[model samples]
Target: MKNSEEFDDSFMDNEKVVLQSIAEDLRTCLPVEAMLPSESLAVEKAQQNCKPTVHVDAFLYDEEAVDLLCEEGKMSRDYCLLCGSHRTAPLGFISHSFSALELRFLFQNVLPDLSGKMLVDVGSRLGAVLYGGCLYSSAAQLVGVEISAEFAKLQRMVMEKYDFTDRIQVIHADICTQTSLLQNADVVVMNNVFEYFLESSEQMRAWHCISQNVRKKGALLVTVPSVQEALAALQGKNGVINIHEWLEELPLDYDVYLGKDTDPESFKQIHLYRVL
Candidate 1:
């Protein structure tokens, strides 16, 4: 990855402004709430009802809108902004920026008070969470583990650009199976990355691997596309576990709770925990 500190403060500020503005525009057009099912039911209610729930259009923003938004910022020419998942045809400028949404959600809940603490960013695609965490907190150490080499390189470039080489390190490794890269962090954050594991076994393996790295009495903040929320919206499976219940199922040595509630429609929830 290449680093360029040559840019003046004004230039950096402008770039930030441009990026933020683009994000804001995309959010306005493609709101997260729209993707959820119209009728909302409690977790228990949906589970007991055992009825399939109706869903709204998952992709609210058309391709044209997404394209226009990206073209203005040079984001249109590249790969997916979120996760670098794949190349989708551009609409106006309403392309899927769920990754951005994920970062913003974390900033609101977990970014504060990170300084002086060691933070491990799990599934650190493009290092968005790593950079956001550093930008928000005065954390003494920042470490990122990403499964994709391309995203790892992007993350390296991003951290270097922000002059975070001294405080942050990015590695290419899978969070589900390998985590020797970070074993002493005070905090570990996994942001909606759990779903990529594909199977329950993989998820459990990944969860165990990451939990082993956190120090006793340290903290773990996680966000998952809430299965409860999804079932609540579709299939009326409200009998499922809520965020608190979901956290309880995790094999951990600490107390966990729903830290912040965001995007109820899409069923995304943030969970915070303190290792005992």
Candidate 2:
């Protein structure tokens, strides 16, 4: 095996191929409308028992390919039964899953070692982080906690299809309810979990809950937006929860993962923190 310092573009290229093959298999059963959580039986069944019946695409880096699989036209609207008023859209109204490249950067650079460790992805929609961990690290266990049952089912289906059941598991429960899981995780990844998916009150409660439960000292906490930025957004807001008390900033040395084709500035938004 090559040392971490010896990693290069050749390794990235090979990993990309493996990742793309998995994505291509998922794309077959995952239509655009089905990308978001849905209660449709057809979509659920298709995802639950998906098989790779077609050849994997040679190039899976194009986000447009995924978008093209979606249903065309405006999304359907919902109305309240009592007052006939419009209600808020579904949980996945906005897509929050990380791109393949971002996942690569995170596992290869931000977290280069995961031997015998357990990783948990909060709000693990579409299981992007979980899949990336399996491919890029030697973590003993990879778990995804998704509140959406539909999304959880999709994740399990994909895992089953890829025969990763030994290392990957998806729990269909809210992250707040899984405090024990959080407490025991060696690495916890929260990718835009609170920004759009949660309400202000829920976000505050979640931060509080996490601070109290995720008490494993020195555990890694990865977030997309820097901790400062996340807190600054709630500076003047009422009922803001301070997470800095429980987490301390950890500087990341990610230069080793950068190459001519990769821009260091692109990852400025990525933040790493350690449990205090």
Choose the strongest candidate by TM-score: 2
Clashing pairs in 2: 32-69, 32-70
lDDT of 2 by residue, 66-161 (tens): 344333432222223445555443221223565566777888888759999999998887788898899888999999999888778878988988
Shift in Å, residue 66, candidate 2:
7.8
Q: Write the per-residue lDDT of candidate 1 for residues 144-194, one digit (tens) a residue.
A: 887667657766765665577988898787775444544566677765465
| Candidate 1 error regions (>4 Å) | 1-105, 176-182, 226-268
Worst 10 residues of 2 by lDDT: 52-61
| Candidate 1 global TM-score | 0.52
